[model samples]
Target: MPVTQSDIALAHHLADAAGAVIRGYFRQPAGLEIKEDRSPVTLADREAEAAMRRLIEAERSGDGIVGEEYGTKDGVTNRRWVLDPIDGTHSFTAGRAIFGTLIALVEDGWPVLGVIDQPVQRERWIGVAGRPTTFNGTPVRTRACPQLEGAVMATTSPHYFGEDAALRYLALTAATSGGHNRMTPIYGGDCYNYGLLASGQIDLVCESGLKLHDFAALVPVAEGAGGRMCDWNGDPLTTDSDGHVLAIGDPARVDDVLEALHRVHD
Candidate 1:
């Protein structure tokens, strides 16, 4: 089924609710704790996710929900909203404004709509399948970089990658750099990197170990902004993806990026 304008409006509402809760905890995350996986969680993460869930339950009853802090709530319909209240807790708790609230509406295993909202910066990017992405009410487009040669790349952190994957990433950067390109590499941004790519500030992003909420909202945003998003295998993103992701500003460059990931390392 196609994503309705009403659904888009509700997505904004969800982001609004989540952002409201997160903004209150800026610079003062309460009840911070390390999860069993060793990732940090905070009161802002929990409360913001809760707030978004409440709205989904109210406005879009019967829609499923998957959240980072609270886990899953099954629904009768195929559509589910994947929510990550604050994507970068380290940045959030440390008083950085790069953290964001991610909301994705996945219908029949495909993301039909996505929103990345940075409450502190008051920047919101909305992407609906088959529609252009928007940032702060203005349409955004990715910069054209057809090959890895001159592309600017980012990942939240290379530390998030496993040893083998880390080696592959390093090889990819090496391929993009040390040539006439002088390709720039960025270290930290979390979900914000996708937003920046949508707005033409970034060229490519590679990440691993992400869950549904982390990358679901990013797919539509990147694609809607005239880019391509896929797993490292050059396949489209799905609800069950293994979490290895690449977002390239230009569709023509995907093969180059994938080639570097494979050929340079293997």
Candidate 2:
């Protein structure tokens, strides 16, 4: 389906508003609170989510919302807005610039629109189903890395895999027998990594311990850029997936990686 101009407008507005809230707390020393899950939270997270939720309600009252900060509202709709108000609250609390905001519109469980806004970095990645993905406003495409050995892979955190997950990841990379592998620390880079993958700057990203809002906005962007995104088991990502995300520039390359990882782990 053709992406509507209104959808783009709303996405831009949401990004800007969320950016404002986050930027307001960007460098300021703020108190941090721990959620029941023990993840850190800040005023920026709460305020930005509240602002985004308010905007969605006022502008798209009939639509449903699934947000990380506030949880779900209403039921599934033809259009559902999925949000991660502040993707890197850890970085935000640390006064880092790698954090971002994620917003996606899912139509019948498929993402039709997506936006990854990095306020501190001043970059925005957008994707509309059936349209080319964009960084800032320019078109972007995934890299042409045909071989898994020639690919560059990234993950959110090795800790998600366990203390020894890094060793396991390194072994996996080595087995790819295709290209160089590097792991970079990124805050709020989960969705942003998919953006990078779409831009062809990065070839693959494997991450676990993610939530629906964490990976939802990235699916369309990756798919729109000619890449494939799924769980480690090669299943399509949904709200119920175990937060394991594997995004790669080529399906064959992704399959090769997944097969190798599973064989070793299984």
Candidate 3:
């Protein structure tokens, strides 16, 4: 079903509520703890998610919820809200403004709307399937990169790619590099990178080990901006996809980049 105006309004409300809760705890040393996975969690992450959940339960009681800090709350309706209260928690704790709240609506196992809200920067990106992406209320579109050689790219970090996967990324990077049109990959900025890509500030973003909440919000943002997002195997991303993901602002270069990455995996 097409996302309605009511759905879009609800998405903005959720982001506003989450942003309110997050701004209260941002960079204030509000009792940080390391999760079992070795990633840091803070009061901001928990409280922001709780605030959003409260709004969701109150406004759309029938919709399910999946979140990072908190567990899932299943509802009878096939529609679900996926939340990453603070996507770049590490950056958030380190006093950086790159962290943002990610929200996605997955209906019948497919994402239909997404929002990337950076409370600190007061910038937000809203994406709805089949609609033009908006950044701070202005329509935005992605820039074209005809080839890999001159394309500008970004990732959170190479370390997150892991040892074995790092080699695969390195090979892909080498393929984009040449004497004059060398591709210098920018590091860091998590969810913000996808928002920038949608705004045409970036061309490619490749990352691995992402979860449903991690990359689900990204799909709509990229696709709405006239780009494409898929798993490294060139499959459409869904709740069932493997963690490997790729985002290219230019559709023409997707096959070439995907084939290059596939070579490393093969």
Give lDDT tens digits, candidate 1, residues 1-266.
79998999999998888888888889773678999999999988998899889999998889999999999999999999999999999889888899889999999999989999999899999999999999999999999896677678899998899988888888788877855445658888899999999999989999999989999999999999999999999999999799999999999888888998987545
Candidate with best TM-score: 1
Which of the two, 1 or 3, has more TM-score? 1
* Residues 175-230, model 3: lDDT tens digits: 67744444578888999999999999989899999999998898998899999999
The ten-residue window of minimal lDDT in model 2 covers 179-188
lDDT of 2 by residue, 117-170 (tens): 999888998888888888899988897876676566776667667544455565
The 0-to-1 C-alpha lDDT of every candidate, in the order given, reads 0.91, 0.80, 0.89
- Model 1 off-target regions past 4 Å? 179-184
TM-score of each: 0.97, 0.89, 0.96
lDDT rank order: 1, 3, 2
TM-score of 2: 0.89
